[model samples]
Target: MSETWFITDEQAAQQALEAWREATVVSAFQAHQALDDTGYIEAVETVIADPATTEKTRRAWNMAQEFRRMSPTVLELAAALELTAAQVDELFEYALTIEA
Candidate 1:
């Protein structure tokens, strides 16, 4: 037997994007230093392509991508994690600004 959410690629894309947007707004911690810029973004896109990326996990990944910058290093994470652009985007969301 098998199970599925029946979610389309477009829907997954939207959810993955939203996940990152939401994450950035809420996650206040400095990103995992190990994670390069675009690290989260690549992760989410990979999720969108993967069969295992559940809605719940995709949402979590989005939260992770938010507030992060876009950089070339995304490629490194992509290669290492075997992720896609959308999956990386899924890792994060919006972010609140801080006053210095």
Candidate 2:
């Protein structure tokens, strides 16, 4: 017999939405891979090339082991990419699902 979940639509949506709200960090690879998967690579390249981005932020972007949600680089990128808070949350959540 097949197993079935008894979750209702509202419950499922709530659960999904709630996930990763508290997740503030992910590996750099996960972040990049998520962006690539979501077709944001070119946009990221543009962000990297933007003159407003400081050398420190570029260095962090290129070399950091992990990315934090509240970091300046992330905030800048999110703004440049026009990603809403919900989209950032979804991106982080999706990034977490990627295999190393």
RMSD of each candidate relative to the true structure: 14.5, 8.0
Error of 2 at 1 (Å): 58
Across 1-100, the per-residue lDDT of candidate 2 in tens digits comes to 9998799999988876655454568999999999999999889988888898778878888999998876788888899889998888888888889889
Per-residue CA lDDT of candidate 1, range 8-93, in tens? 99999898766654443323243432233435544536644576645554444545553333433333445547766655554432
User: Which portions of model 1 show Cα errors greater than 4 Å?
Assistant: 1-29, 33-69, 94-100
lDDT scores in order: 0.47, 0.85
